[model samples]
Target: MADRILTEEEKAAQERRGAAGGAQRGGPPHMRLGQPTEKSQNFGPSARRLLGLMAPDKVLVWAAMAFALVSVALTALGPKILGRATDLIFSGLFSKQIPANVTQEQAVEGMRAQGETKLADMLAAMEHIRPGQGVDFTAVRNVLLLALALYAVSSLLSWTQARIIVRVVNTAVYRLRRDVQAKLGRLPLSYFDSQPRGELLSRVTNDIDNIAQSLQQTLSQLLTSALTVIAMLAMMFYVSPLLAIIALVTIPISIGITAFIGKRSQVKFVQQWKSTGEVNSIVEESFTGHELVKVFGRRDEVGARFQAVNEELRDATFGAQFISGLIMPMMMFVGNLNYVIIAVVGGLRVASGSMSIGDVQAFIQYSRQFTQPLTQVASMANLMQSGVASAERVFEVLDAPEQTPDPAHPETLVDPHGRVSFEDVSFSYTPDRPLIEHLNLCVEPGQTVAIVGPTGAGKTTLVNLIMRFYEVDGGRITLDGKDITDLTRDNLRSQIGMVLQDTWLFGGTIRDNIAYGRPDASEEDILEAARATYVDRFVHSLPEGYDTVLDSEAGNISAGEKQLLTIARAFISDPALLILDEATSSVDTRTELLVQQAMANLRQDRTSFVIAHRLSTIRDADLILVMEDGRIVEQGSHAELLERGGAFARLYAAQFAGALTEDAEAGQGAVPRGVPVH
Candidate 1:
């Protein structure tokens, strides 16, 4: 077959598709960060759901709100209380102007009769005034002390409310992280197959942290700000309704500014997080495939990809912050305008004697209080929007459909013989494209079956069915005459051991990595498994021997050593069934022979399924199955299939064609090239 060349655009698209596929494992299409932001459609519902995370702590939240309310009420009442001192001082000054011989009422009436109506009214409105006293220093002192006490109490309540809110936020976020972790475990393999790892990780870590911060910073402040707005409005109206009306004119304008900027900024915040996920995906993939990238000299391409996604993140974050930032200054602008208007109107009322100097003073203070909270509310819109965006992303993971649960009454596997059979099984990763169909196979308890085929020929898929990593769309598989589906996945998997082409070892001792298959294994069992797999041969050369700790990536060990350790892991389990998918592919030819010998020993009396592309590795198998496009086209011993001269013959001939010519030139028997050498 000729290789079809791709157009430039097609190549770019393919790269993007590859990047998307590499984004971890596959997940929901909407959650994929390949195309960029997945904006939350309903802000109200998302915000409500985010708040609902704190439902378990609602009692604490309500207590905090109550404290904030009382705190704000006290704060709002402070100016009014202070206004009393002003009234007392001014009233005493007016009383001293009157004659000491006249009574307080008579002085006021005489002043009114002498065409001093405004002064008479001002003096009449003053309370607790002695006719000849210049000022009552004791009353003034008491008023000052009372105002200070109210402020001190309000500060204490504010601190208490803040502390409660922080605890509630921490608790709520803790639960959210726990729920997400549990949800990830319940998700099906297919869900992970298409998802990007970095993107999902961002949701789990970055998004959750952002949620906590948003709640901690804004929840209490929002509660206090809201209450302050209410309390201040009431105080303003009580002091003078006309001035209060003038102050209210800015409320609608502030709302308009917040609504407009908040709407645009929300979209940017969504983009910011999505771009962040994409950036994470790129970095993770680049790091994981660093050697391959260096070999291919794709460093420039990777850097460009990172730069592009990072630029998107930068733009998104900038846009969100810049737009949301407009709210504060804009609100302050509206507030200042309102403040100027209220000051002018309040002063006029005081001058006309319709309102006392202290009353007008309190009214102006109330006006300032009302506008300040509105400003805070406007500024908080950014944090709320960003947090809601992250919350919705997290909610998506929690809402993903879970894998089918294990049966309520799970069947237990008895002291089992590993006789496995697939009964006309059919399956596909997607509904439109069927990969495997009507496949039937059975391996006896002690048989070693080898599966060989080209890539994408369902060789690995067959064993996966036996392990129940995925369920068949049609028919069922069985072990020991019982349907595998009836058994819990853990129970079924417990009896099988798998060593794949890719090796995985965590940051732990070599002994720990080997014992991972059966943590309950004794020290002797671990050492025995290590010896059986040839892992002991190399461990003695290392500085720490079996105790040597592997890094997270296991970079300290060679690939062949890593593969050997994985094999020892399988050996320690001593499972009834064993699966080796090109398990020796990573080792050198010398190491491969040792591994094959080790495997041979481990396979004694075990039902082992070996998937190999290196034909030499499976030549001695008791049974060999030739698969193509999801069906077994041929099945027999290696020599039997080579003599048959069919698909297996063609594959064998193609692989060893050059070596056969060299053998013929060396004067060996001119037997058919497809024939297996004994």
Candidate 2:
């Protein structure tokens, strides 16, 4: 099972359940789910790498930033412009109250004589005022219109900046996803053998998505927020330096709170994602192996495990959100406090004649704008942290070591005869445990070779080596006298076809499934292969015939029918070499006979290797090799091995002993050669 090619469902389960981890880290076996395997240990490097991915789109980034700057600048000037209209209203009202014949100087003198010193001072400070004039409605309307225009243009630029940022973020994320996918292909199979599948899936799917969302939401807002803060500060100082200094007092306090909370929440965010991956793994495994859990009556155990992991996720998420959630309210507190102080001080300054009422009002607005961005920055801290955490996982995939590359100039097979040779082959899954050592074998152009062995006897490993799924640790494997390593992996594998015990059919029509073996094959060829494998016999009975859509599990088809479809798929490839690994294990006696007939036709001119536990299927093979542990113990013709009564004979006898007894009691002298092993 471990040596077989993993189906999508199996890969999801086995990848994270790698046997390399001797002891689990997070909790009991079920709760562990390979937790913390994907957690980020370093934040800075990962963040820098993530930023580096955007280097290709720096032009767009700079453009967005520039637009944000101009937008913030224009927006900051709006309040000041409106302040002029405020001055106009005040001055117009006072001017209308005065007599038409009186001059501005006369009005001030009259107010002072009346003991209205503050009012006299305020009136004296007013500009462009005439004693006989009424309110200037036209001038006030012009100022209001100018202020509105500035706001409208500023909003337009802000929207443009957001659109530019959206493009930049999505492009960067798309490239990141592509690179991660390519990285997965380059990594060695052993890497998957050791890592959890669910964790990698999370990194590929969930983590990348989080990073995309974080960048999309934060990039534009943070850029604008920072610019707004700078622009507002300048406006505040321009209106009144004293009020600006008071607003600056809240900066240190806000920074202190953000830094303190951000640090704590960062750790919790890592745990939160880690637990999320674990939960995903448990659910994936439970659903993939749902039938097994029920057959074993372990549904309660699986449910309990899911609940425990879910609780862990809940706790981690709560801690992260609660701690980071403090930023907004705390920042709001400091902002409101700054607002109150600015209002009070600006009022005093206005009364002292150091500032006009209009200036005080504008300065108060500037103060609010200044602190609003600080509050926004504080609130965005959590999103940034979570995104960086997800980035770390993605970077880990990009940073993983890749498999050995193919030769710059590869060899090719000329008129290939399917001759294969193993020259002193040495291989193992681990360094400390050697499975196959100094092995050598050769097969002719067209010979059917059968291998029989007990479990863990390295039966599947031999075929895996031929496919170069794992490179030989030492020595060389050759095809037609050429070292297999000299050829590209694809070039070497193109000549071979294999059908395993566990049949894999994707979600597609029966014809589509068969065509998967040779994508370029025509419809006639697909139909011919199906007919040859007995798939046509039952497929025609279906409502859609060969066009029937198979679900993910292909549950509409029986196990034997699925097995026939896989054989048909293999048959369509029409390769020079074929491998059948316990291919008949899933079929009943009648179906097995049909499968055997199809295989016989498929194996006619190809050099075939058959790995089987039921010795009866391989009795007519040209050569039979009996194996024990990792070594071939004997090789001979089937009848010769039975006559020798050695390892092969013992295995054969054990499988058919009951059948032999029944035949003897039924008045038959001997068991027939083709009796089913089971």
By lDDT, who's the top model here?
A: 1
Off by more than 4 A, model 2 = 1-44, 97-121, 132-134, 657-678
State residue 357's C-alpha deviation in candidate 1, in Å: 2.0
Clashes of each: 14, 2
* TM of each candidate vs. truth: 0.92, 0.90
Evaluated against the true structure, the overall lDDT of model 2 is: 0.83
* Residue 94 lDDT in candidate 1: 77
Write candidate 1's Cα lDDT for 1-678 as tens digits: 000112122234335657665444333353343233456657889888888999998899889998998999899989998888898898888768767787878987998899988777777767877877778889999999999999999999999999999999999999999999888877766555556678788889998999999999998888898899899989988888898888888888988898888989999999999888889888988998899999999999889889988999999999999999999999998888988887788777666668888898888788888888888878888899999999878887888778788999989996778998989999875576677899888889989999988877788778767877677999889998889899998888888887777788889999999989999999999999999889999999999999999999999999888988888898888888888888788779987888888888788888999988888889889899998878899999988999898888778877777777887899884656456554
Give all candidates' CA lDDT scores: 0.83, 0.83
Model 1 earns a TM-score of 0.92
